[model samples]
Target chain A: MITMTRETLFNLAMMAALILFPLWAWLADEPFMITLATKAVILALAGVGLNIALGLGGLVSLGHAAFFGIGGYAMGILASHAQNYTPLIETPFLIEGTKSMPVIWLVAVICSGLAALAIGALSLRTSGVYFIMITLAFGQMLFFFTISWPAYGGEDGLSIYVRNGFPGLNTLDPIQFYGICFALLALVLFFAARLARSPFGLALNAARQTAERVETVGISPYKLRLTAFVVSGMITGLAGALFADLNRFISPTMFSWQTSGEIMIFVIIGGVARLFGPVVGAVIFIALEHLLGGLSDYWHIYLGVLLLLIVLFARGGVIGTLTGREVAHD
Target chain B: MTDPMMTDPVLETRGISKTFGALQASKDISLTLMPGEIHALIGPNGAGKSTLIKQIAGGLRPDAGQVFLQGREVTGLDTPARARLGLGRTFQISALAMEDTVLQNAVLGALGASGRPFRFWRAALGDKDLRARAQDALERVGLQEHAATRTAELSHGQRRQLEVAVALTLRPKAFVMDEPMAGLGTGGSLRLTGFLDGLRAEAPILLVEHDMDAVFALADRISVLVYGEVIATGTVEEIRANPDVRSAYLGDEA
Candidate 1:
C-alpha cells in the first residue's frame, strides 16, 4: 500500500473541503446549495461503484444504470409497501416490503449481482466493441421495461412519503445523509484499490494484456472477468439505494441509457484506471452541470463540444492531464 | 539407459502431429528428456520446430498423439496448467509483461510455486519470502540490479535474460526454451551460455536453437528435424557425421 503523502494529502484536503460544504451553506442560509452537495455525494458514490469495473477491471459496462435503477426500485417499492401495509409486488406468493436501508442494500446487491452474472456470462464471450454493444443492449432492455411497466409509476416514477429508517441517525438531516454517502464511497474505493492489487487483479490485468499468458499461468480469463463484473454490479447497486434516498423518489429515468452513458463519461473524463479519477470526474461533472445550466439552455451542446475536445486531445482525463502519470499496475 | 531417464522423463512427446488445413506443420514427432540432459531440436526454417514445441508447451493442441510429464498425460491441458505441473517454456518472440518491472515479471513465474495468488488485499511488495525467491531467480540470470527496471526499458539481450529469470521462478523440472539466444550479441550469448551451464544440474532443458555453435557446445544429444520429421537423433558428433542430417539440415560444412 502506498503511504498517503504530498498530492494524496492535497487530494484529501479537497475532500475535507467537500465534507464541510454544508457548513458554508448553513452560514450563508443557502439550503439549496446544501441539498445539491448532498446529491453530488450520492451520485459520486454511484460513479465510484462504476469505477471498479471501468477503472480497474477494464470492463466497459454501459448497462450499470440497470443496477442503479434496481437499487432505487428496491428501496422505493419497500417504502411504498411498508406505508400501505402490504406486499410490494405479490403474484400468488412472494412477500417483500421493508423500509430498512440495510435490507434495501442487500436486496439491491443480490438482484444486481444475479443480473450481472447472467449478462456477463454472455457478454464476456465477446471483446472490444462487441462487449460495449452487448452491455448497452442489456441496459436499453431494462430501461424500456421500466418505462413500459405500470405498477410503480411506469415512466412517471414513484415518490416516497417518508425517508427510510437507519439504526440511529436522523433521516431528515442533509449532513447526516451526506455522511452515509461519504462513508460508503470511501469503503468502495478501499475495496476497488485492494482488488486491483490482488492476484485476481493481476490476472485480470494479464487477461487484458495477454489472455494466452494468463491461461498458461493456470487461470481462466472468463471466470476472473465475470467475478469482477458481479462485484462491480453489487457495489453499483448499493449506490442506487442511496440515490433513491437522496431524491426521496425513484423512477424509470434512473435506469435510462443516458444515465449509463453519463456514468461512463465521468470515469473516462477522470482517468480510466486511476483510483481517485472517478471522484474528481464526478466533482467536475456536477460543477459543470450546475455552472453550465446557469449559463444557458444550450448547455448540453456546449458540453458536447467540450467532450469532443477532451476525447480528441486529452485521452487520460483530468488526473492524467494534471499528474502526467499513467495508471501504474504492478 | 538410466533410471532417471526411465522414471521421470521430464518431457515426453509420443507421435505428436498437427495439421492446419492443407499444411502439416508437425508430423509424428516423438521425443523424451531425462533429468540433467540438454536436448537440442535443430531444423530448417520451415521444419516445424516451433509448432512441435508449442504442442509440448500446451500452446497448441496436437491433432494426434500425447504429451506427458512424469508419466502423466497432459495433452489436453492449457499452458498455465502445464506450467503448474512444473513445465516451463519461453517464447521465440519474447512473450513477457513488458509494462511491468523485471522483478514483477519474475514474480509472475514464481507466483505459481509460492501458492495462493488469489489474495487481492494483501500487499505482495512487502512479503519478504516472495521477494527473496524473486531475487534469487534474478541473481541466477545476472539481473538482480535490473529487477526494479521495467522490461520495456531493457535491451533485447537483457529482456532475453529476464525471460530466463521468469522461467526460473517456477523452479521448473524441465524448461522448453524456444530460441533463448536469439538476437543476443556475442557477449550476451556467452552470458546466456554460462547461465545455461549452471542450470544443467537443476533440470532437463529442451533447447530449440538456430545457433549451431551453442547447440554443439550445450547439447548432450542432438536431433535433426527436416520437413516436420526427426531425420536424425544422436550425439553431436554422430549428427555431424550423418549424411542425411548434413544434406537436409546442416548443409555441407555445418
Candidate 2:
C-alpha cells in the first residue's frame, strides 16, 4: 500500500489553506475576492473531473464542455421552471416544478451520464485525433443549439433569482457558498485519487499502453474507455452545476469550445497525467489570470505565451517539475 | 500415428485455413492436442505457424474450417473469449503490460478463474488465495522473486518466463505459445525447457519454437511444416529419421 509522505502532507497543508483563503475574504469583507475564489474552486472541480479521463485513462476529450453545459442547463432550466411554478413545455399533459440543490445535482449527473454514454459510445470507436474531433463536434453541436434556442434565456443566458438552497446552510453568505465549492472540490479530488488506484483504473491504464495485452486478459478496451468516459462526464457535470450556482447564471458560453480549451489548459499547465497535477494547474492558472488580468487588458496574450513556453520547455508541467516524476509516464 | 482413440483432444484444428487476398497464409491445416502432451509445431519462416496459432487462439478467423477447445467449437470467438474458455496464449513479440509489475500481470490472468477481474474492486488485490495462486504460477517458471519487479526491467529470458507465468495463471487446459524460445540465451533455453517439462503434466502445450534442441528435448509429438502444409506429424524420433523432414529443415544441421 502506498502511504502518504511529507509531499502529501505539504499538499494537504496547501489544500487547507486554499479552503480557508475565501474565509479570509469574509473576515476582510472582500466579497469580490470571495466570489472569485469560489469560481476558481468550481472550475478546479471540473478540471479534476477531466483529470480522470485525460490523466488516468489517456483519453483527451475535447468535448467536456458539453457535459459541463448540460449539467448547468439541467440546474438552470429546472430551477427556472420550479421558480415560475410552470412546465418546460405545454407537453400537452403535465407540469414539473423546480428542484432543490441535491435534486438538481442528481438530475445533472443523470443528464450528463446519458450524454456521455452516447458520445463515448460513438467517439470511442475511433482513437487519438479522431476521438478528440468527435468530442469537439458534439460539444460544438450543444453549444450552438443553446445559443440558437429562443427559450430559457438561450444565448442571452438564464439567471437564478436566488441561489439553489443546500440543507441547513445560509448559502446567501459568500463564505458559506465558498465553503460548499471548496468541500465539493476536495471531495471530487479525493474520488479521482481513489479512481486512479482502483482495478478499473489499472485496466484503463493497461488499455492505454498495451491494448492487445489487456484484451488477452479478457477486458475489452472499448467497455473500459466508455465506462471511464461516462464517469468523467458526470463529475465534470457536477462541477458545472456548482459553477452555475456560483455565478447565479447559466449561458451558452458554458458549452463553448473555448471553455473546453481552458479546462484542458488547466490540466496540462499543472501537469498532465499526475494525481495532484490538475489541482496544481488550476490554482496556478487562476493565480496567473487574476494577477495578470489586474495588470493589463491583454492578459490572455500573456497566458497564451506562458502556456506555449511551458509546453515547449517544461514538458511535464509544474507538479512534474516539483516532484521530479515524469508527467507523461504517470 | 494410428492412435485416434484419444479422449477429447483439448484443442483441435480441422481444415483451418486463412487467406490474405492473393496469399494463402494457412491452408487446410488439421492438428489435434491431447492433454499431458507437448506438441511441437515446427515450420520455416512465412510457413504460417504464427497465422495458424492466431487462428487457434482466435486472434484471426479461418476463412475455412473450425477450431475446437475440449470438443466445443470456438472458431467464432475472439481472443479474450477464447481465453475465458481456457485457451491461453503467449505472443510472438511478448505481448505484456510492460508498465505493470510482474505480480500484477500474473494476478490479472489468475483473477479470471474466479470471475470478472475489474468488478471485484478492493477485494481482488487483498485476496490471499489469489496472491498465493499467482505466486505458485510464478514459482513454476522460477520467477517468484521477480514478482514485484516491473516487466520492462526483466531480461529477455525472464520476460519469456513471465509470459509463461501469465499463460499458466488461469490453469488453462491448452497453452498456445508463439516462439517461446525466441531471443533466449543458452541458459535461458535450458530454463524454458525445464519449465515446460514441469507444466506438461498439468496442461497440453502447443509450442512454436526455433530452438531444435529444446524442441527435440521436450516434444512428445512433433508436427513439421513447409509452405503452410504439415509435412509430417509423429514422435520426435520418427520426425528426426524422416528424409523429407531432413531435406526440408534438418539439412541445415548437416
Candidate 3:
C-alpha cells in the first residue's frame, strides 16, 4: 500500500486548489481571478528557482531579479523586433527576432544561466553577508543599466501589442495562459523534487550543513553550488519570460531589488526547503494583496508584521508548522 | 607482487613548516606512515599537532613542505582533491551532517568515492551499489543498526564511529584521523581502540590523539611534537623511555 505523509498530502491539496480555483473562476465568469492565479503561478515558479539555491544549497542569493529582468528583456526585445519587422541584429549576419514563446524561453534560460555562472563564480568566493551584498550589488547594477539603456524603451519599458503565440492555443485568453503557466510550474516542481533526492542534492545538502565534512568526503562545494546557481537562474528566467508574456509587457521594475525580495518572501513565507513552499507562499501573498488592498493603502505594513512573525515564531512557515520537522527517513 | 610498503611510504610529509605572524605553528616537520601500520602523533595542547595534521590533510597549505601520498606529490591539492586521491580523513570534532541519516552520510562518502555525484535523476538511497558500499562500511564499524537514525541523535562515541564509517567508504589508501577518541567513555574508547586495531590491515592510520592508553595499545609507532617540532619518534617503548618526549608531553604519565 502507498502511504503519504502529512506534508505530501498537504502539497497535493495545495496543487489541487491551485488548479481548481482558476477553473471555478472561469465557470463563474471572473476572468480577473484567472489572471491573478496566473500571476501567482509565475511568481511561484520564480520562488521555486530561488528555493533550489537558497533553501537546499544554502546560497542566499539577493540578486535573482537580474535573471528575472534578463528573461523579461529577452521576451521584450524579441517580440518588439518581430512586431516592428526588423532583424534583431544585421551587422555581420542577420539574426531575426521571434514572436515564439518557446524561442524566447530558450534564449531567456541560456542568457540567465550564463549570467548566473559569472555572478556565482565571483560572489560564491565570499560567504554570508558578503555573498548577500555582492548579489544585491549585481542586481542593482543591472537595474540601473536597464533604466539608462534606451534600446527597449529604457525606464518607460516595452509592450507587446499582442501576447506571444504558442503552437495552437489562444494566449490572449486568461484561462489558457493560466493553464500554460500552471503546467510549467508543475513540471518545474517535479524536477525540483527529483533534484532534492539525487546524489548531487545529498552532497549539496551536506555542504550546507558542514562544508569541511563534504570536502573530506571528496566533493568540491564550490562546483556544486555554482551548478545549482546556474540551474536556479535558468528556472527563474523561464518564470520571468512567462510573466512578461502574461502581462503583454516587460519593464525595468522586473529587475528591481523589491522583485528579488518578493521572490525570496515566497520561499520563506511558504517554507524554506519545502518543495511546494513557493506555491503556498505565492497564493497567500496574492490573496493578501487582493483582499487587503481593498481595505487600506497600508497593506505593506500588515505584510511587514506578518513577515516578522514568520521569521520569529513560525520559523518553518505554514507547511513546516503544520507538518512539523521531517525526520530523515520520513 | 612485491609489497609496496617495502619500497615507498603509504603517506609522507617532507619538511612541512607553517608560521602565523610571529608564532610558529609547525617547523620543519616530517613524518611517514608505512602500509598496514598505525602511526600515532601525540603532543601537549598548542604544540601544533592540529596545524600539522591540517597541512598533511590538505586543509592548510604549509609555508614550505611537500606531502606525498603513495610517492606522488599532493602539496598543491585542496582537501577534496586529496580526498579524491584516496586520502580519507576524520575531524577532531565530529563533522557528520547532523540533519541527514547515518546511511545518507555514508552514501555521500561512497558517492564521493565513485567520483560521479552529478547524476540528477535517480535517488541516492535507491542506488544499489552506493547503498551496498555505505551499508558495508556501516556494518564494519558496527553501526548498521543505526543506519536510519539522524546523525545528530547519535551519542558522541557513535558519531565518532559514523565518522570512521564515512571515511571507510572512501576505500582510501591512507587515513588521517584527528582525535577520534575525544569525548568517548572508557567503554567506548576500548571498543573503538579494538576496532581501530583491526582497521590497520585495511589502510594505515595517521592518528592524532590525546588518549595515551588507546595510543599505546594501537600505534605501531609514536611521534611526539613539542614547540612546533618533532621531539621524538620511536616505537612505544622507546617513546616512553625518551627523556625529551617524557618531559615535553608524557611527563609524569611516562
Candidate 4:
C-alpha cells in the first residue's frame, strides 16, 4: 500500500493547482492570466534546474544565469536565422537554423550542458563562499561578453519575429503555449523526483551532507557534483529557451546576477531540497509581484520582509512549514 | 613466522614521512598490515597518529613515502580512488550523513562498492543487490532493527557501529579505522572490541586507537608511535613489555 505523507499530499495539491488554475484561466478567457501562469511555470522550471545543484548537491551557484542566457541565445539565434532564411554556419557543412521548438530545446540543452561542464569543472574545485563568488564571476563575464558581442543586438537584445513552432499546436495561442510549458515543467519535475531517489542522487546527496564520507565510500564528490551541475544547467537552459519564446525576446539581462538570485530565491522560498518547492515558490513569488506591484512602487520592501520571515523562521520554506521537518523516506 | 617475502601484506606503508612546517607530523613511518590481522596503532595525543593515518587514507599527501594496498602502490591516488581500490576507512569523528536514515547511509557505501553508482534511473533503495549488501552489513553490526531510523537519532555508539557497517559494505582488502573507540563508554568499547576481533578475519585492520584495553584485547600486533615514529611493533605481549612504549605512551598505566 502506498502511504501518502503530508509532503506528498501537498505536492499533489500543488501540481493540481498549477494545472487547474491555468485551465480555469483559459476557460474564463483570461489570456493574461494564462500568460502569467506560463511565466511562473517557466521560472519554476529554472528553479527546478537550480535545485538539483544547489539543493540536493549543495552547490551554491550564483552563476546559473550563464546557462539561462545561453539557452535564450540558442533560441534567439536559431529563430532569427530561420526568419532570415540563413544558415547558422555555412562552413560547418551548412547548418541551417530551424524555428522548431524541439530543435531549439535540443540546442539549448546541449549548449547549456557543455557550458555547465566547463564551468562546473573549474568552479566545483572550490567550495563554500568561493564557489558562490566564482559562479557569480562567470555569470558576470557572460553578461559582459553578450553586451560587447554586438552581433546578436548586444545590450539591446534579440527579438524573435515569430514564436517558435511546436508540431501540433498554435504557438501564438496563450493557452496552447501554457500547455507546452506546463507539460515540460511536469515532466522535468517527475524526472527530478526520480533522480532524488536514484543511486546517483543518493551519492550526490551524501556528498552534500558529508563529503569525506562520500570519498571514503569510493565515490568522488567532485565527479558527482560536476555531473549534477551539468544536469542542472541543461534543465535551466531549456527553461531559458521557453522563457525567451514566451516574451518573444532575448536579452543580456537573462544572464544577469539578478536572474540567478531569483532562481535561487524560488528554491529557498519553496523548501531547499523539496521536489515541488520551486513550483510553489515561483507561483507565490509571481503572485506577490503582481498583487503588490499595483499597491506601491516600493513593493520590494514587502518581498524583503516576507523573505526575511521565511529565512529566519521557515528555514524549510513553504513546503517545510506545511509538511513538517521529517523528510519522506521514499 | 610468516615470512614477508612469501606473503604480501594487505596494506603497507613504507618510509611515509610528512612535515607540517617545522614539526614533523610523520617521520619515516613504516608499518605493515598482514592478511587477517588487526594491527593496532596506539599513540598518545599529539604523537601524529592522525597525520600518519591521513597519508595512508589518502587525505594528505606525504612529503615522501609509498602506500601499498594488496601489494600495489597506490600512493598517488586520492581518497576516493584509494577507497575504490579497496581501502575502507572510518573517521575518528562520526562522518555519517546525519540527515539520511541508517539504511540510506549503508546503501551509499554499497553503492560506492557496486562500481557503477552513476546509474540515475532506478531507485537505489529498491535495488535488491545493493539493499542485500547494506542489509547484510547492518545485520552484522546488529543495526538492522534501526535501518529506518535517522542517523542523527542513533546513539553515539550506534553511529560508530553504523560506520563499521558502512566500511563492511566496501568488502575492502583492508580497513583503516581512526579512533573507533574515541567517544564510546566502557561497555561500548568492549562490544566494539569483540566485533573488531571477528572482522579482522575478513580484512586486516589498521586501527588507530586511544583505548588501550580495547587495543590490547583486539590487536593481533600492536605498533606504538611516539613523536611521529613507531618506537616498537610487536605482538601484544611484546608491545606491553617494550620499555620505549612504556615510557612514551603506556606510562603509569603500564
Tell me the whole-model lDDT of each prediction, alpha carbons only. Answer: 0.80, 0.83, 0.93, 0.94
Each prediction's TM-score versus the true structure: 0.92, 0.93, 0.99, 0.98
Q: Highest DockQ, which number?
A: 4
Chain B TM-score per candidate, please: 0.96, 0.93, 0.98, 0.96
DockQ of each: 0.50, 0.45, 0.88, 0.91
lDDT tens digits, residue span A132-232, model 4: 99999999999999998887899999899889999999999999999999999999999999999999999999999999999999999999999999999
lDDT string, candidate 3, A12-65, tens digits: 999899989999999999999999999999999999999999988999999999
In the range A169-228, model 2's lDDT, one tens digit per residue, is 988888888888888877777766666655676667677877777777666778888998
Error of 2 at B169 (Å): 1.9
Full candidate order by DockQ, most accurate first: 4, 3, 1, 2
Pairs of residues at least 3 apart in sequence or in different chains that clash in candidate 2 = A82-A98, A270-A281
lDDT of 1: 0.80
Better of 1 and 3 by lDDT: 3
Clashing pairs in 1: A198-B120, A216-B79, A216-B80, A217-B80
Residue A95 displacement in candidate 3 (angstroms):
1.0
Q: Which lDDT tens digits does candidate 1 get at residues B38-149?
A: 9999999989999998899887999999999878899998787888888878878777777667877776666656756666786565556767888898998889999888
Most lDDT-accurate candidate: 4
Question: Residue by residue across B187-253, what tens digits does model 4's lDDT show?
Answer: 8898899899998888899999988888888889999888999899999999889888888878889
TM-score of 4: 0.98
Tens-place lDDT digits, model 3, residues B96-140? 889999999999999999999898989999999999999999999
**Regions more than 4 Å wrong, model 2:** A89-95, A312-315, A326-330, B1-6, B120-124
lDDT of 2: 0.83
Q: Where does candidate 4 clash, by residue pair?
A: none
